[model samples]
Target chain A: MELRGKELNKSIATRKKEVLENTSILSEICQFLELKDVARMRSVSKIMNVIIKDSQFIWKPILQRTFPEVRILDHLTWQSLKNVYKSLRDYHYLTFEPHSSYTVGIIGSLGKLKPYPDIHSPEIESSGIFGGYSNYLLGKHIISISVLSIPSIKSIRKLRAEIQCWILQVNGQAQGWENVLDEHVTNFKMNQIKSSQILIVINSDQEYKTDFILDLEKKFKIVILKYIDNKTFENLTKAILKICRNDGETERKVYEKQLIRTNIDENSVQETNDSNNCILS
Target chain B: MFYNFNKIEEVKIRLRSAEGHICEVEESAALMSSFIRSMIEGFNEVTEVSLPNINSVVIEKVIEYMRHYKDKDPPIIKKPIISSKMEENTSAWDAGFIDADWNMVVDLMTAADYLMMIPLRDLCCAKMACKFKGRSIDELRAEYHIENEFPSEMEENLEFQHPWRLE
Candidate 1:
């Protein structure tokens, strides 16, 4: 028997045009598709390929949906967002790598090790899982540092001046290093170390002991940083504050208040003479 | 044909399908469709709405969904819910409502898409997406009627590169 009718309607079983023909429907379908499906759908046809690729142009929502709770910055474009996502994926399969580099004239700083730089500290390797995005070697790193004494001292006051110069250099290397009694030590420790030095510890004549053998190994961590943006290369205090702020909203506010308080106090203003402070301080 | 015997005033909506069939549904149930809602609001006096794209069978399925979730809002499935949990948590009725052949599901999705019924669209699409997950290239091609664009040798190489297929 042949089926005949005034109107022959198409069966719903043959229709799939909402996903194939309609743009918004196709986009909504694409959102539900798995990542591998998205990649595979590209191979389906030229139209599907174009649609999926265009979806990436609106990548901010896609990325947020992919990884919720991450505060994605507005400045991150699609290309950069993809790069960061790929790098993060790369992080899972990362293998360990060893790095051994040295810096001289460091009295006692190890990589992130705090308290007394003792050379007998087991020859430890660094966690090298993370590396530069352009140039940031993340995670723990070991650095062998050598100590040096003042080159020449003309007088006692001259030795104190040289010691102050040395303290400035060490603190300069630590960049954001802060110590409550750092200035006090620079003013007094030069003469005290000499008096405390056993008479046999001199590298030269007693009257003009410009050099000494004091192996007081203390562990201090090594940190060298260069912020990405050039605008951050202003006053060291401001740069440090700016970096702290970049971490999050709450920390930024707390650190901002700290910077304001620290900026107000000076040696003269606070009446603490570094020259008159105790030798060990 | 509403079950109400009280003979109270009830608003009736007329929907014309693509096959030229007219379906009369209650205004409250029809308002669940954003497209129909807009039409009702836009032309307050109009009783019938025409949908030239959807057919009788798919339109009946769409109305079944709309009427089911009319009084209470359809619980939105955030983050694309489709799993054993989706089957477990969904009422026996919702599961049965969307239970159709792949092509029928696709048709219903199209109808829901036309009506701007987001929940039904999402449900249908996610169901299709579930069919694609963990299926091989051959299985997907068979199921979705997708043409295999790659030769055996190239497809083998892609499997080697992706390695996700290996799992």
Candidate 2:
């Protein structure tokens, strides 16, 4: 009886090995794994690593099944699908603290704003900006720039900020920066900021008047001021303006037309409405 | 030449397992397997189908599944199963049906694949995936009896190339 039990155990072990070694069966099994799990599975053995890395068959079905609305565009190669899967899994959140009275103008490839479901802190108001059109661009990519009224160190500690947005990429290129400024401005208007004084604060370290800033100065009334906090703002604004020059002309036209309308309807209290008043706070 | 529905339902198909054990199942239940259905179609009078790769134990389990799902379709198991527990990811019946030892699940998966029973194959695959879900590389290797074939340098390089691992 003991020998019979040993034989059965041997058969079970053999069957387990057989199932694991079979590439087709292994691949089918992988289709139900999360992206991170699949990545971890690659380290198991040479056969598993090859089965995962060599083809898109395993990844494609998982991607399609998980995100049915997201279409895999023609330009994306099979090799990049794994990376795409990883990016989709990584949810991007924008966190900042705004002063009580300061209305923050967020500009980026943002869709309609909805409350972020994950945060439970009542002190913090978190909104997730769904990038509807940009979802077609690439895997829910978002780049967000937040314009905050200079916060007192006390208010910064008091209020917690978490904003989510999609950053767009096309053909593995960082295309979110292109024509994003105009979209940012449009989204700002949609948020209904009635402030006549628009502040364009640059960080203390960055060169004061980049051509992009100069171009922005041409469109809005000019004041250049320094901000001490958050070095990320400098890099983000520079990146946005650096790419904003070439294709920005068309968007600039549409923005100028909107600006004229906003000045007339929203900021009627200000007497001189030649260009929207921008004060560097 | 009209056939009575009750008569067709009364037909029994005999399945011969690898261990030469014969199991009888309703014709309608047996036809759930595309492999058996094709065999029956090819030879109209074929009442017994041979499954050489599947053992008697696994074949009996497959027959149970076929009998339960004879008149209806199995609930679809969603891809990238959200939970590690099979019960949370699928119907209670499916979860209970698949609640077996790892060896049994593997054998059932192999049998389902051989029999061309896609729903059963997918259910088994999902159950297997549940074992793999949220497990670390070392854990996976240990559980599956896989030897780490990569050298230290190659493993490091592979880790560096992993997009998700960097973060």
In terms of DockQ, which candidate is strongest?
Answer: 2
Task: Give me the runs in candidate 1 sitting further than 4 Å from their true place.
Answer: A1-23, A40-50, A57-61, A69-281, B1-6, B82-86, B151-167
RMSD of 2: 15.6
Model 1 residue B42 lDDT score: 93
DockQ values of all predictions: 0.13, 0.43
Give lDDT tens digits, candidate 1, residues A139-256.
3221112222222222224333222112112322233323412432343355553311111111111121111111221111111222212211112223232332244545544544
Q: Least lDDT summed over 10 consecutive residues: which range in candidate 2 chain A?
A: A163-172
Could you give candidate 2's per-residue lDDT for residues B1-167 as a string of tens digits? 98787655578899999989999998999999999999999999999998889898998999999999999999998887888999998899999999998888888888998999999999999998998899888887777666788999998887777746432
Q: Output the lDDT of residue B139, model 1.
A: 62
lDDT of 1: 0.45
lDDT of 2 by residue, A1-281 (tens): 99999998787767777776777887899888876787777777887777776646766666657665343322234345654555555642221123111123232221222222332334333233221110221224422233322112222323323322111111112244224434433433454422122233332322334455457656443322233223223322322322232234555445444444443454342223334322122
Angstrom error of the Cα, residue A64, model 2: value is 2.6
